[model samples]
Target: MRTKIILTATVLIGGAAFAIAQTSHTGHSDGMDHSAHQQEQAMTGAALSEPGQGAFAALSELVRVLEADPNTDWAQVDLAGLRAHLVDMDRLVMDAVVIETDLPDGISAIATGDADTIATLRRMVPAHAAQLARDDRWTVDATETNDGIELRVTSEIPAVVARIKGLGFFGLMASQDHHREHHFMMAQGKDAHGH
Candidate 1:
């Protein structure tokens, strides 16, 4: 009988403490609504959503697009190929060195780099030349060299000639708005940029 009475008293005290805690936290006793605290956290939380790097941001964007699309083939997804292409782009931009010479209308560039960079240039420059050739205003060509790649751009339009010369090799390489669509196509396992 004595043990049962002590157990009942302990249970009553515990329940009362729990009820008080609930009332205070729920804004019934302390008069501050916890809902406001939750709203503040939602408004000013320190958890950022950035991917924190360029290539990663690009990949994440592609992932989001793929996830949102019902027609995306999960089996055919080729993010690794896309990443390799991104690395090639990085090498071309960051590592390749170019010497420019005057052409009648535009410019010629002897683009050279380390072996890996040269390899990247070999893969990219000709493909870019093909893309530029599609424009009627410009003539573009790239040739493989023993050490690097040679690229020439010429245009009959005087203003365009000036622009092409101003752009030179790297800028011309970076030119055109086809990259995003090409990346999308590549992620979809399509022959974007002809490879």
Candidate 2:
């Protein structure tokens, strides 16, 4: 009786696995075998069968190469398909975060020192911010500062808002000096006289 029960359990589990393997999934773009046999092989440590596998393989190779010798110059490293998932918009925001995050600690914000950088950044992030605003992701708030225009994103994320209010992303561009006295610029650099 115990032997029969064990055989029955094994057969039932195998049947369920077979049923799941036949169904198609829509969201994932990678074309690969989703069969139970393939899953079992993966569980057993075989090579992964998916589109981004090559990307992962490349990353692994990069790590190995770097590990073998730590002095690998960054510019020489090949990053093919390394950023396949990042959209242009996300890339721009990421760039802003990267730059702005480098500002001095405890600073609520940092303004761009050059007109070119400010204009370009504004063109990139504000549009995304505007869309987010419409969706109530942020409230459109623009204030004139001593150096240049200051765009603020007022959102409902209290935690993020608190951090931004405390140690946030703010800055002024050196080009628009006229707006200076009209607003209290946060950082270094004196009034319009290129000071």
| Per-candidate local distance difference test | 0.89, 0.42
Candidate 2 differs from the real structure by a C-alpha RMSD in angstroms, to one decimal, of 18.0
Residue pairs that clash (backbone atoms under 3 angstroms), model 1: none
Cα lDDT tens digits for candidate 1, 1-195: 999999999999999999999876775466667577668768997554666577788899999999999989999999999999989988899999989998989999999999999999999999888887888899898999999999999989999999999898988988886889989999988898664
Q: Compose the digit string of candidate 2's lDDT tens values, residues 1-195.
A: 999999999999999888777554442356655586577887898875353554454455545655577665555443432322122223333344322332122222334445544554554334433433453433544444444445564546765455444534432222123332311111111221211
Clashing pairs in 2: 108-168, 109-170, 110-170, 110-171, 111-171, 111-172, 146-180
Which number leads on lDDT? 1
In model 1, where is the ten-residue run with the lowest total lDDT? 46-55
Whole-model lDDT for model 2 versus the true structure?
Answer: 0.42
